[model samples]
Target: MHWFLAVERRLTRTALELAIIAMALVVALTFYQVVTRFVLGHPSAWSEVAARSAMIWMVFLGLAAAFRMGSMIAVDLLVDLSPPAMRRIVHMIVGVASLVFLAILIWYGTAMALRVRSQNLAGMSITIAWVYAALPAGSALALFGVIARMMEVWREPAGAHDDELKNVEGSV
Candidate 1:
């Protein structure tokens, strides 16, 4: 579990960093596109396509960090109201559901990428598959994050979450 968690931590960190870079790229490209189109009176189709691609990659790559942080979809009120055992069960169900969703993403995302492998971006020479690849890659990283979070939760003492819950409540 320790080894798995260590690797997961690294994966999450890397995913987050890449996501940030992708976001920055998206912003820069979009800004350039705007300046070229509006100010220079010459639109850049390639920059627009590149910005969109970067945005897609940014969203997908950030997925692992969101899951690891427990900021993914949740019915927090229900979980907070449950007994410790019930809370664990709820967490398990949510974790399993998340894994299943990610598995589906990986399966279909890979297929989609393959289907479009021969197609190029509208204004770029690169295959569109490169853009779609983020789906499976990010989901794979998120798998590790979900498993690590589940493990961390299970390892906690039964009453340990009470204080944590209070802290969360206060923050919100």
Candidate 2:
């Protein structure tokens, strides 16, 4: 159990780091685009599309990172009032349901990305599949996060120190 937890923690940490890097890249690209467009008087044709696409990826990755940290948004007024044991059950059920939903998203998103593989974006000559790819990739990461979280919930000991609340914010 300790070993498993160590692995999960490492995985979550890695996701968080990757999300931070993606966010940084997006900001840098946007800044670069603005500077080049106004200061240099030469706007990039693909910068707009690239920046927008990067934002999409950033959002999705951030969602998965949030899930890993147990920071996904939730209305827990009722749960807060419930008995501790019951609250654990509720959390377990919700986490499993989320896993199911993410599975479906992974299925549909992968199909969608593949279906548009040959198509190109209207403005940017890049393949549409590249844009759609973020959906499935993000969903897959989120699914793994959900499963990891559910396992932790299921095997968790009584009075366990759980720090899952710090990771939930605005996710995709």
Candidate 3:
């Protein structure tokens, strides 16, 4: 279990790096688009499509990192109010439900990616499927994050702070 956790952490870190790079690329591309359109009086068609594509990848990749870091929003008031025993039960239930939801996303996302494989983006030569592929890829990464989080939750005591709000409050 510990080894699995270590691997998940490494994978999550790599995903975070990729997401950062994608986000940076999106910003750069958008900036270039703005400068060319307004300053140069000539906009490149490819810049808009490229920026959008990068943004899609960034969003999806960031999802896994956010999940792994427990940075997502959640209604944890009820869980925190529950008894220790019940709290653990609720955590397990939430974990299982999250896994199920991610699994569905992976399944449908893969189907959609395949369906659009032959279709190209409107202003680019790249296949639309490549953009769609981010969906399943992110969902798969999120599945691992869910499992890793479940393991952490199981190892810790009940009523522990496992969401972002608690961390923010503690820092303040």
Best by TM-score: 1
* Residue pairs whose backbone atoms clash in candidate 3: none
Q: Which runs of model 2 end up more than 4 angstroms from their true locations?
A: 1-7, 75-78, 158-172
- Quality of model 1 by C-alpha lDDT: 0.85
Q: Which RMSD does model 1 reach against the true structure?
A: 3.2
TM-score of 3: 0.88
lDDT of 2: 0.70
TM-score of each: 0.91, 0.80, 0.88
Clashing pairs in 1: none
lDDT of each: 0.85, 0.70, 0.80
lDDT of 3 by residue, 17-60 (tens): 89999999999999999999999999988999999998999988
Cα lDDT of model 1 by residue, 18-100, tens digit: 99999999999999999999999999979999999999999999998887777744546667778876887777788899999
Candidate 2 C-alpha lDDT tens digits along 1-172: 5676566566656666667777787888888889889999998777777777877777776667666656644625545666776767777777877788878877888999999989987677789888788887877777767777667666766425244433323222
lDDT for 118 (candidate 1) = 100
